[model samples]
Target: MSADVVAGWGGGEAATASGKKTLWWRDAPSARLAALGVVAFLAYLGGTWAFPLLRYYRTPLLDLGKLLDHGVRGGLLYTAAAVVCLACYGLALRIASRSGARLGVILVFALLFSATLFFSYPWGAADLFDYAVIGKVLGQYELNPYVVTGVELAGEPWVDYAPWSDTTSAYGPLWTALAGAVSRLAGKGLLANLLAFKGVALAFHWLDILLIALCLRETRPDRVAAGVLFYAWNPLVLVETLANGHNDNIMLAGMLLAVWLALRGRMLAAMLPLAGAVLTKFWGGLLFPLIIAAGLREQPRSLWRRLAYLAVAALLFGGALALGWAPFWAEGQGAWAGFRLQLFTTSWPLVARLALERWLEPARAMALAQGLALGATAAYALARAVRVRRAELTEASYGLIFFYLAFGCAWFQPWYLIWLVGLAAASWDRERLGRAALFSALGLLSYLLYHFVWFGWGLDHFSIDGFRALAMAATVLPPGALWLARGCMANR
Candidate 1:
């Protein structure tokens, strides 16, 4: 055998020849920083357990604005810590490929990161307010939130001021209904029930975090520790979903869990979470198709059984839509049609409006444009999926992330990009010339600039045009890193 093959097998041979030894630290500055980064990040997340919801109450336990404003404060802290925490996660990953017994080091980082995410509180983003508005309709007026907009629900005590809430979001009504259930349980003059909704989102987010851990464990057991940092510590996730209190985090958490289960040959079990995710946001349903493709990878009774799971999952999704409009389907076609209109439009719904307006008389063109976008993106994804190795789940996941965001009409809120950081981080190969380093630096910088401007956090709107400046960094970093990756891939 060649000398290289012998060296590659050294670790296994050494363990048999000698014995395993514990490693408490990595030698490099990057590894030391990775360890410190994990600590600062955990403390940051753990800090949120004491998050003062009462600060926002106009009265004690009722000042809603202050509570949300505090979330903005947390964002700055996040930008600082995410840089270090994620850096370690990325750099250590490359090192581990050449080392041994570093799983504990990685696991420590992951644990702290996930713990931090668990404690973080979402602020008063428009979507969170929308959840409250819908909850109030069910709680206060004894009416269906699906039938009314936030404007109509404005007279209620729980509903907050957000112009966007007047419209139905493409997010299905089941999540709203679930929020309504929380309102019913809380029976509040305070925003306690709205908080109950956040608690539920938090639980699901953590559950999803575990799901990600388990998935990484399956394909890359040693790297599971690093995987934790990527998925858990990401700032886009922190500010957008947790601090901003958006439902997409929980929705995605559910989707990722389902993806994990399906990949592990538990298609039947994956169905419920996938359905829950879809009910939370229409986008969650994308996994059903993804699962179908994944199932096609192997053929047998097990794979055929997935076909049954997919059928049941689809029926469940349609049933969720029906729950919102069962009787209304026959009596209120106009309202139902309006509800259907929401299925396609998002944050920048203007493009969808124009494309369908007067062109195909609204309805037909709307369906066509939406279908075309979906179909085109799906084609890109399936094509990319062709490269997925049995071992590299991260690459497959990141491909989905890029496809989902890039193709959608400009309707994205910044938080929509959070999930990509984890997938990308997991996929990083240090041999690929600091690809993880580039991603860690740029993904975070863009997220920081984007959120600060969007929130007016110590800066006015377009105050510094910071995002544009940050974009310059993203542009330069990738092409520059490409050569490094090329050299590594070629040399390897």
Candidate 2:
């Protein structure tokens, strides 16, 4: 590679003052940073190979069952690998910021990390099997996944693996259709279907990286490499989107594309992808008013022309939503299944509900928690919408998502962190980026808490409330304490 390209690969200047071109590898800081990237990649690869979830599947290459027969030990090993990878990520980011890394190096690492993790089983979640069952319901069985529970296809090989076989699909219609297409393409093999969904996630993961880079180039050119590294090297993002094969990456791709399109002044064109995002996952809908307001602000000042522009944008957004939902609506028979997912609370919200149950009836306590979450989210959204500017759109979106994930989300998972990290990548706000990184790292511990401590170690046998208390402490305290400390420091 040329010196320019090599320089972009985390290397410093390649030419000496005497007009002599030095080898790129000769630069100490760049070589060290690049080495850190490699370490991070290897750590992730090791974690994937050692993942306890692989024990469920039989593979000749590695007898994962034998290796991970002990749940506690296996969980510890996997957690250690994750911690090492996260540490490397932090060091790499710090070094890259000071030494000036480039996109070429970041992209190389992203591809390597993704490819390695792609082969590893999604140890943190069984959501992939659920996707396969849903896909089969739509593709092979010719049934609407949202309307039909996987239990109806219990005899199918894929259905045997899904944990939620009795429940209808909670995914949006757009995702259901895509999953169905992948399932049809993969045919009757269960593994084939799993890999096919993962493949789609992999494609969108790359798209997310590219779109983030493109959006940053427009809004924060100076921070492009840092932004890419923030999202690309995040362990939570890599594991969740690639290994676990969650559809959130696809949702994020749509959101990022919409942001990019808007940044390019194609206000009307932006609505399509934004709509696709909402159809993929309802969280994307939160950005609608903010995006629409920003778009409207960019229109011609003439009253008639602005009104016409508004009408066209609405029609375009509504039309896209209608098209995506039409095939699976089934006269709204089971169309609301996806929204019902929010009724099942977890994380901090669950803790809140349990505490409230001491005073109120169980149902009422849950309702109060859910209602407060909704109200808080709505208040924040309205306050943000009034002040959000075109330039502040990405940061605004990040704040909104962060708010919902922190408070409003009734069912939060580690994979949901992808939404925050994805948008934060395009933003120049270091504090938000730091918060995203912190959450991504801590989020992985949820798996440890849920899998190893609660279930694996049989802590649930003692007291479920105790386990919830532990979860609340583990997931919420660190960030909460940090935010408090930062505020106190700022006051001084």
Candidate 3:
């Protein structure tokens, strides 16, 4: 690599085999910062444990009712914790950017932090238990998760703690199957099942880190460690993937693996992981246009080669859908029919329904809004595909995907930002990285308004209360202001 690439703002070399990449505190200030990052994370963990309703209110350490009654104090404490977490994230990124952190050192830090956070409270989300319930329903009862939900498994002692008990699996089939496999191995203990699921999440988290490093190695070899650290040490990623145990990380790992393979000139092989990503989460399939564009951009491209690539990609994706989802496809229209429930239950549709209730009927308004979002996303994808080339494929793809996800989607959760973070990390777009980090940090304020009922928050029910509006503003303002400022600067 050229010196400009090697000296990418950081004095440290990228993954040197000599005396440079040592773990000693003196040689590696990044390592010391990594240790400090862990300390900050531990503090965040402790604060989450103290928060009410995030964990079971009846935990031996905390009384949920008592904590909730002190609403103002509780909210303040939670906000304080969030602020601390964001602050630490900023520090870690600053250190990583300047120190030219080694990938090995960062991985060591990521593993240590993730392992400890695994034991921490789920922290404002109950998705982990919900995953376990789906697993138990599928693995133990042999029921189709696409058709049945945690409500059907209410008889199980652990089901009481899971959220969205009334809804069927919101994810794609591969995730449910993998959850079942893990559940079966977990035996009957509720704690054991939860731990097993968390372990699976942590493993996927590590896999994503590794794939990101590999992708950056291909795209920005000199800044591989910085890119990896950018995603791996992200507070939102750690909390959402490991603590809450969301399966989005697994889907992301598959997606990044496909990108890495594609960058290495293995476009055909890339389809396999892309298929796995799609089957893991349907969002993965949305990336197909970008992949196709990258393939078409290859040198010596001809009609036949393009056709062959299209045919193989289609076959792989279709086969994955047929194989992974066939069993749970339901009667008639298959799993596709069941997915409609997901749309109606999601945040955006609900918001649209509420916003348009006075002017239009709820159902029609939701349909219109959903149609518009999908149409716009499709149009954007086509435009990107028509102009995309290998030289800027990653950057262009990330932009389109982030646009659709950030503006087109109805619900904007913190973990959703992980997709953009992973892509931005490899794309070597510092501005995009800054925006994503800011959004993720601020998006977390959504939890401040979470209203846990007799059980937990469900997709079917939500209110556009004042707190919810404040949370929405938190999600929008920072990024919006940054865009406006950039525009003003350009004009000047």
Q: What TM-score does prediction 3 earn?
A: 0.85
Local error of candidate 1 at 182, Å? 2.4
> How close to the true structure is residue 133 of candidate 2, measured as C-alpha lDDT?
84
**Candidate 1 lDDT over residue span 1-492, tens digit each:** 122211221221222212443223422422464555556565555446545344443332221234334356655665555565555445554444444333334445445554454434444244555566677676666775556665765455444444356664345556766776787887765456546666776666566556666776666555554455455545455545555566776677767777677667765566677777766776666556556555445445585566765676567655655665452233342564455544532222334444466567766766666666667667766775565543444456665655555444334444565555544544544432244345435544554444543454544444232334334344333633464467589898
Better of 1 and 2 by lDDT: 2
Candidate with the greatest TM-score versus the true structure: 2
Best model per lDDT: 2
lDDT of 2 by residue, 163-194 (tens): 77778777777898988898899998877787
Q: Give the TM-score of candidate 1.
A: 0.66
User: Which stretches of candidate 2 lie above 4 Å from their native place?
Assistant: 1-23, 51-71, 300-302, 332-342, 456-458, 461-466, 480-492
lDDT of each: 0.52, 0.77, 0.69
The per-candidate count of clashes, in order, stands at: 13, 0, 1
Error of 3 at 80 (Å): 2.2
Error of 3 at 375 (Å): 1.4
| Cα-based TM-score, every candidate | 0.66, 0.89, 0.85
Residue pairs in candidate 2 whose N, alpha carbon or C atoms collide under 3 angstroms: none
What is the TM-score of candidate 2?
0.89
Report residue 121 deviation for candidate 3 (angstroms). Answer: 2.4
